[model samples]
Every structure is written in C-alpha cells, then in structure tokens.
Target: MSVNVPKPITALEALERAQWIAFAPFVFQAARVLRDRGILLAIERSREGLTLEEVAATAELPIYGTRVVLEAGLGIGLVTEVDGRYRITKTGVYVQHDPMTRANFDFTRDVNYHGIAALDAAVASGKPEGLKVFGEWPTVYAGLSQLPESVRKSWFQFDHYYSDGAFGAALPLVFAGKPKRLLDIGGNTGKWAAACMKHDPDVEVTLMDLPGQLRNAEQNLREAGLLARARFHEADLLDERSAIPTGFDAIWMSQFLDCFSEAEIVSILRRCVAAAGPNCKIYILEAFWDRQRFEAASFCLQMTSLYFTAIANGTSQMYRSTTFLACVHAAGLEVEREHDDLGVSHTLLVCRPRPM
Candidate 1:
C-alpha cells in the first residue's frame, strides 16, 4: 500500500521562520555598540591575533560580554574563529582599514545609530534633529571638521567613494572627452579634478570652494600629481565677490546647490551662465525625490533633508527635473543631456549656455 504524503504548507513555514523577527532590533543595537568601540579594528591590527580575554581587555568589555558579541560577529561573517582564537575576515578588514569603511561606520555612529528610531518624530514634525545631535554646526560639512582625526579621516575616505567610480560610474564617462579648462564649483577636496587629470593629462581643472576647504583641495590635488593641471579658487557660493571664472569648456557641480532655497539655486545658475561661454557645458549632479519610484525611498535622504533643514535651513527634498529646466531657462541655458543611473538617487543634468 502506498501512503499519500501532504505537501509542506509554505505560509505556515514562513510564519515559523518569522519567529526570530522580534530579535532583529536587539541584534542591530548590539552590533552598533561593538562597532563604535573599534573592537573590529583592534582585532584587525592584532597580528598573531588575540584571545577573547585579550580582546575584551583591549575593548574594555567584560570577558563574558565580549565573548558573546564576538561570537555573534563571527556568526555574521565579520570575524572568524579557529579553535579558541578569533581573526578578522575580509569584510572586517574593509570595515576596519578601508577609508570608505571607516567613514561609513563613523557616519552611522555619529549620525544614525543614536536616534535612528526618532525618524518618526522628524516625519511627524517635518524637522530634523541633526542640529540637536550636532550642536552649533551650520552644516554637516562644517561639522565634519570638528570630528576626531580618526573619524574625520574615515569621513573623507568614505566621501571618495562618491567620485571614485563606485557610485554611478559617471566620472569615467565625464572624463572620456579630454576637455580642457574645467571648472569644479563647490568641489570638495578636488577629487573629481584629480580624477579628470588622471584620465586626461592635458586637462586643466580649477577647484573653487571656501578658503578653508580650498586649502585642503590644494593639498589633495597636489598629492594626486594633478597640481599642475588643477588650480584652487577660494570663494563662497553665496557671496557676489566669489564669482566663477569665465570661459571654461566644462563646469561641474557635484552634490551642490541642494543646500539652498530655489531662489539661491537660480542665482547660482545665473552666475554659472555668466561664466559659461556659448558652447560651454555644465554638469549638475544631485539626489532627487520621485513619487513614482517607491523602492527608491531611502533613509539617508530622509535624514539628510531633516538635517539640512534643521542646521543649514536648506531644503532637502528632490527638486524636480522640471524645476531644474526652469532654472536653466532663467539662466539662459538649455539641457543638452540627462541621465538617471540605477541604485543611485542622483540625477545628472548636462546643460549648455544659450547663444547670446
């Protein structure tokens, strides 16, 4: 006699699997605590490795508590265990030593980890707590300078990822034409200029930023063997005295202009128009909100909008492409090209000055 067997019920199985869902918050909170203490870094630096007791001592965690966290980290692939010793994994190395890794962790610890759950308050009130979190700081960029050297290095390191051909693969495309006389407005550290010069040796790139930021840009460009091709101009975006230099073939504004009102953006665009020759091309890259893209909603954008509003009194939501087109029209420019890449919140708007 053959026995009939019943098929496994998928819904019931899924419910059983969901039993651990409630523990997710505790797990995340615990991981954050371990990350802030440099526990992962300590493990990475310890050649010949350290025992659990030693790691606990170095991290100032109680031995039992340290063991529990390390065990969890090991299970999560952040650490490896052989016999009684623990070693850092490849992911661990990236987190501990990689500039981007360090920056991301520090950003999370300083900005996100403390009050991630308070996002509802921001949403409800339409206000950010970043200023409350980081007191007296006019902008996140300004506040970054006040971070500890280790944390600051991490921030800069992570910032490199944006233009380092990781985020949108846009830089490589932008540098392909070998255009001479490039203007990088609000260019932080001149990373894009350095990248441009790296690809095309003949291109001359000028980085314009605030005096303090310009000093850093100068140093960074010089270090990248691009000082000859790159020049630094110190100016504030808001001040008329800080006018952009004229007759550049191409202009770049990356992650800029979002920190201001629509009027301010129009003013800046007008200045860009004045500096641009008839044939000059302008590149404007920024994150924008789209109501149609449901999955595109990101916590980072939510946090940034609130933070910018709270601290800089700047708008954070995506200014629509239509609005940008209007600005281009007001500035006597036309949008020649536009691109929206997958997995990135930014929109690239390429424009050219109108014939007078």
Candidate 2:
C-alpha cells in the first residue's frame, strides 16, 4: 500500500519560511555595515580584482578584519573569489551604484544604526530619543548637513531607488495618452520630472521643492539634459500662502507625504487639490505598511521610521491606503486606479477631481 503524501506548500508559505529562517540579528547588522560602505561597489570597480591587502589598504581595516569581512561577503554571495582575488557578483552590482544602495546606506548609517540602539529607551518613554542617539541636530536632513560632503553625497544615490523604479514605473500608466503639463511636488533633484520628459518629449514638467532642494534638483535636471523640459519652483508645502500653479493636466507627488504628521498630510493634500483643475490627474507614490500581509512588512519602513525619528526629525511609517483615500475624498477627488507593487515598498494611487 502507498503512504498518503501531503500537498505541496504555497509560494507565500515558502517565502514566510525563508524570511524567518534568515532573520538573524547578527546577519542583519553585518549586511547593513557592508552595504553602507560601498564595499560591494569597490569590488565591482576593481576590474583587475582585489586582495585582502588591497582592500585593507583602501578601506583602512586591519588585514585580519579585512579577510574576515571579505570571507563573510563571499559566503553571502555578494562577492566572488577567483584565484585568491575578490570581485563583486552580478547580483551585487545594483548596490554599488543603485539608488536603493544610497537609501539603504542612509537608513542604516544615518537612521537605524543609532535609533534602534535606543529602542528600549523610546519604548520606556513613549518618545523617541533620536537627538540623544545622533548627538547632533534633531532631524536627519539637518544632521546630514553637518556631515562631510562625501558622506552627504551618498543620499543622492539613495534618492534614485525611491523615485526611479517606484515613481518611474507609474508614469506611463498614469500618462498613457501624454498630458500637456505635469507638476511634481516635493520633487527632489527633479529625477521624476526628468523621467517624465524622457518618456514624453512634449510634456513640460515643473518641480516644486524647498529652496535648497530646488538648487540640487536644478543641477540634476540640467545634468540629465532635461533643463529645457522642466522649471524649478521653491516653496515649502507647509506655507499657507505658497504659490502653486493651477490648470495642470497631471500632478505628481512621489515619496512626499509620509514625512509628516497626519495633520500636515491633510494640509498638503488640500493644497495639492487646490492646485489641480477639474480635468487634472493626480499620481501619488509612497511606501505603505500593509496590515493584512505580514510578508509585506518592510525592513526599510521599520528602519527609516527609526532614522527619521532620530535624525531627520521627520516620521517615516508604512501608511495605509485608506488614509490616502480619505485625503482624496477630502480634496473632492476620486481614485481612478490604485496599484501596489509588493516586491518593492511602493504604492501608486491615481486620482481625478470629483465632479461638482
């Protein structure tokens, strides 16, 4: 007689099992340190390959520690060893120059590295002890201003991961027929605007951000050869009398809302609605925490929240779609389409002005 066999497990079940199996704190911390330092990128750049001696000389790590680190990286498949020389693996290329790399590094070095260490204190006081941990400014952005220029430049790379895939993925979908005018609020470095212009040559985009961020955005747009297609507007979203141009065919808010309190989000949403005309389409891209999907829980969210609280004086959390829907409703707009990409921490909400 044949024994009864159990049915095959689902993909979701397999993913859950893998997640738990790989959730060691030591492994997580080691990964963070390696990713932050551009170690993988350095290996990739060394076309001639590098040895422990070379790595130690470049990174200023002790010879013994360098060997240990390289070995650990090799075990993790981030590096490949050939004839005693180390090189970056194909899968590791993204971290070397990818936008996600910068974002991840920023979260670890600037935010989580310090914040998580004080989790017990935060829990006891019911208030984040971010400044105490960072020992500098109250906000991450402000604190970054104090770091060496080299360290500060890494954030530009991180901005790519947040905007490139998540925001860029939705543009074609939202602007299927090519809209005439596009407004990008909190548009840092004008990368989203550059992507929009790249996709639709006829589209003229405007980027609105803080004055300092506007300068960076202008430089980026100019470098991307998109200066002709975009204009920079300097204004804080929190300001009541801030001038926001109206009658645009499309309005884009990429990775902007989650930086503030609920009240601030409501105010910004109201302002966004007022800036759009009856026919204007709105696209909102963000990372939201999915309450229903435990597999969807974000390490980026947990880490960034801690970082923002400690360093940027901002708040980062996985917001809910219902919260956004409410904002749309309050603004007299209706959701046209909603797409949530689970693999990456991104959600896209398309909206149109509600009929009077």
Candidate 3:
C-alpha cells in the first residue's frame, strides 16, 4: 500500500533520534517542570545566558533541581548551555510562549501522560486500560464532563485548537443549501451549534450527544444566547437501537468520528443513513493523517492516535482519508463534495445518504 513517510535518515542520525526517543518521557516531564517552575522563562528573560546560580535564584528552586532540569532541557533541545550558563533555544521559546505549543504541552502532560503508561496493555487488550487513571469508562467521552478542571481545560483547548478555526470556513459550505434546520452529531459544548446560529439567523440546530455532554453544550448555548435557536438530544450513537432524530436538511459531525473504532464509525453512519432523508446533506470534518500537507503534521497526528488507544478510546486513531471514505461507502453515503485544508488540519467531506 502507498503511504506518505518522511525521507530516509542516515544511520548515525537515526541513532541520535533513537536516543531522544529513549529519554523522551523523562525529558518531557523535565521541560514541564522547568516551565512550571519559571526556570525556562527566567533563562529566556536573560539576553545573555543565565548562570545556574541566577536561574536557581529566579526560580526559587534548589540549585540541584535547576541544574538537572536545565541539563535535560539542553538534551531535549529546549535550551542551550555554554560555559556554565544557559539560555532558551528557538525551540524553547516556542514551547515557552506559543499558545498552540503550550496547549499541546499541557494536554499531553495533564491529560495523557499518566494514562499513556498503559499503552502496551491497551494495545494488547484492545481496550482503554489507561482510562482507569481517570475513572472507569468504556471511553473518555462518558467521563469527559467529570474530568478534573485542569484536565478538562486542556482537553477542550487541545480539541478546539484544531477545530475552532474551521468553523468560519465550514459555514458557507454547510449553508450552501440554505437548510432551515441542522443536526449536529456529537456536538460537544455547542460551539458549532452557536456558530451555525450566528452564521444563519433563521437556521435552527439540534445538538445531539451523550446526556453528560449535553449539559455542557446547553450551558454554552445558553451563555451565547442561542438557547432559543438550539435543541438538545441525548443518546449514545454507538448503541444500534438508539434512534437518531430525523428530518434535518443537514447533518454535521466535526472531529467526532475519530472518537470511535472503524466498526463503530460504520455503525454510526448507518444510523445517519437511517435518519437522513434522501435530500439531507451530511458533512464530516476530520484531520486525516494522510491528507496533511506537512510531514510534521502527519507525525503529530500519528502520535495522537496512541492517545486514543491509551486514554480516549482504545479502538480509534487518526484515520487516513481512504479509510474514512470506505466507511462512508459502507454506510451507503456518497461523497458529493470534498473540501480540504479547511483549517490547520481538517478536511471536510460533504456527503449524501445513498438511495436504497
């Protein structure tokens, strides 16, 4: 099968990369601690590299702790040291100040770090063994509403970072048919619903998801003064018997299907097919790995799939476009239009339920 992979590297260079891999987890925590403790910021504030003594003084940490983290930061390419003084590297500044990078870092540490410890077990069992770290649930969605405030913050921010930007671009495509009503499947926190209401004053949306999630969505819609234009439905789409309310002109699933396994995705789509009228338009927005323009972006998505295995749901991953298309066909949906590069990493597939 054809795949897009990075160019080959020399044996010595590969070995150096392997060394970083061996120390990555430890190095990640060191960077987190350093950032949290103000060591990195203190170093960055110094035009000239700061002496170990100065960093310790500014960070209010013991000299030994500061030295260890700074040394590891050097190894991680987050900082540089010369003649007993340290300064932030270009990479270090991004980690220190960039919003996206900071969000990714916090998400990886606060939400996925401990759970990732059970990755091997999750892989072996085909279950979210690491999810036990938070609480017992088949998937993270069941417990998303109850996650600690910090974890929930990072989780939502990480999710919205990639998806929120796509809303403006997606609006015209979704409203191209001027549908009076839309069904937003898996509409967490009602962000998309609010966007829809604002984009088309006459359009009304029904936000559907698990009951726990709808509470969050209701709160958001209420805050946005969109409660009148929005309706809520609580159902687990994974259950074959759970009915999807019908009669909407459009159905929108944004960054939603990636939460389930291949079979579950097919099942959900089939349900959509059952609920959707012949004329209903279905829009699925996903960040498929193979569709990414940059190898780095693809690489980030490939790693995030592991987060699904260990923490989110053991069955899903960042999918390839072909894989999602296959599921669409299996569910008797035809891709009527395809939009790519909608945001930093999303591709929108506009579909129609195939005739029986």
Candidate 4:
C-alpha cells in the first residue's frame, strides 16, 4: 500500500458526502426516533408497504411527526419510499437487527452521546474530561459499577459482545500445555477464568483487579459454582510499588492491555515478566486496527479510539499491532507465536520470556 493514496471520488461526490457528515447528528437522532417509535417496525411488517396513515396508526404517532421522520429515514437510507408508501431498506434491517450494530448503537447512544462533546478538552488536558458527566473518577473503570443501571448494562453489553466470541477460540490454545495455575490480569466479570476452568476441570485460576471489579467477578464466579477453583487478589496496577502475584504457569490478558497507554503496558508487562517462571506462557488477545480483515472493522476501531480519548481514559487508545509489539519486547518478552483472525476481531500472541 502506498503512503500517499490518490482520491477515488470526484469533487462533486466528495461535497455530497460532506453534507451527510454535516447533518449526522440530526440524521442519527431521526433514525433512533423511527426505530424506538415503531415506525420502522410498522413499515417492515406490511406485505406491500405502509401508507403514511397506516404507519401513523400502527405506531400510534401523529401523522405530522411520522411523516417527517419517514422522510428523514428515506434520505438516510433507513427507509425507502415508492409513490406514497414506505418500506424498510437493507441498511435499516441491519440497523435494527444486527448484534454488532445493536451493541455499538446502544453503547454510543447511552454512554458516549453526551460525553463525547468534550473530546477537545480531553485531548488538551490528557485526562478523561468527558468522564465528568458521570463522576469525578480517575477513569471509567473506577466508576463503572456506580453508573446508572441502564448505562452499566450498555457498557457491559458493548464490552462482552466484542470479546465473548474470541474466548472460545483462544481457550484451547491457552490450555494446550495444560497450565495448572493461570493468572488472569484485569479479569473483568470472571468470564475468561470461568471458561478456562470449565474447559479444563483441574486448572485453578486467579483474578487480579481493583477491589470493586473483584467483587463483581467473585459474585459471577460463585453463581457459576466455579468459586471453589477461583482466587481473588485486589490489585492496583498503576501503583509501581505493587507487585503482581508470581508463580503462575500461564498469564493471560485479553483486551486488557489495550486499556492502558504504551508506557503503562510496558510497565505492566515488566511486572508479568518478573513474575513468570522460565517456562511460563504470557498470552495477549487484542484487536489491532492494522490486523483487521475488513476495512469497515478497521474504520470502526479507528473511530472507537476516540471514545478512549474522550471518555474511558484520555491516554489510551486501541493500538496497531506493531506499536503493541514494541511494548512486549521492551518488557523483555518475545512473541513465540501469533494467531490472527481469531473468532471476531482479535489477534492472539503467545509470548515467552526472552532468553538471556
């Protein structure tokens, strides 16, 4: 690929595309109103198409309001109009039904909608200035459990939807050596640790994270009857004085390191390197923008990096694989093997201690 790429669209087309971005906020809200008001569903169910009156009646909305939203949806490609009736479009089908679309939509709307306006402030201050909308916490992680019930649900749905698919595929590789003791760093919700124990009846797992997150993970593990095999360590990785627990056969970090900056990642990995025995395996599961199979996935990741900047943590963003690799090497670890294109957008790197 060339560093300087030629333009693919004409100037007229570029200007037309620019208009879509200019009205994006209005268009997004229009789509949401149509979906939530049942206007889209009413149109979708009609065998032929829904007349303006029919849509208004079915959705129990005023014809004046319904007409404007339908017209907006038509221009947005969420709905199509023929003569005088409206029908759902292919794009609308995905907007209303796709799992990934739903997760991203709810997350963006519920959690990021208002906060994202502070992007410029966060960029200038090097802090999550948008997090002020929720509370005066160091990061979103610290205030996660205390967020509104609906907001918390959206966060978890967005977080788990991306990682749940990768866990099944990565589980076998992590246990290929049949590690007896595994340390799950940043074990959010205990999902991966539970999966490991279920996959291997004899493997004992330890969860290390902040005190609050540990409580949530403990409750989840207990509910699954896996607590007998699970242990919890309240840890604060940012504290340089804190020492990570040692003597584990395998150390796992899945979508965890990406939550930190490169400097923080190096510091955390150094702790992992210090803790690992000679034969220990350190696995990292992440979605690197450069490693994505599709341009759309890459675009989504690029935009999501802004969420980290504006809301999650000001210093961290989803990293390219090359940048992430330097951190691992800096911590005295080397990638023994790399498996890309795992279950959903993830690259699994199996790292081992560097030789003297």
**CA lDDT, every model vs. true structure:** 0.67, 0.68, 0.90, 0.90
Q: Write the per-residue lDDT of candidate 2 for residues 1-356, one digit (tens) a residue.
A: 11123458999999976875675455445555555555666677798788878877877778887787678777666688998888888656755556555467554554456456665665455445655654555444445445556545655555556557665568777688478888998887777788888888899998888777788789888898889988778887666778678878888888777766566676777777778777788888877655224442454565566544544444444466677567668767778877877235677888876777
Can you list the residue pairs that collide in candidate 2?
Answer: 103-158, 111-307, 139-311, 139-312, 139-313, 140-311, 140-312, 189-217, 289-318
Each prediction's TM-score against the native?
A: 0.67, 0.70, 0.97, 0.97
Q: Give lDDT: candidate 4, residue 144.
A: 89
TM for candidate 3 is 0.97
lDDT value for model 1: 0.67
90-167 in candidate 1: lDDT tens per residue?
877775576544555565555545444545564555455444564555555666556557655654654455435323
Cα error, candidate 2, residue 320 (Å) = 2.5
Give RMSD to native, each candidate.
8.2, 7.1, 1.5, 1.6
**Candidate 4 structure quality by residue, lDDT tens digits, 143-212:** 9889999999999998898888899999999999899999999999999999999999999999999998
Number of clashes recorded per candidate: 1, 9, 0, 0
TM-score of 2: 0.70
Worst 10 contiguous positions by lDDT, candidate 4: 1-10
Candidate 4: residue 191 lDDT (0-100) = 98
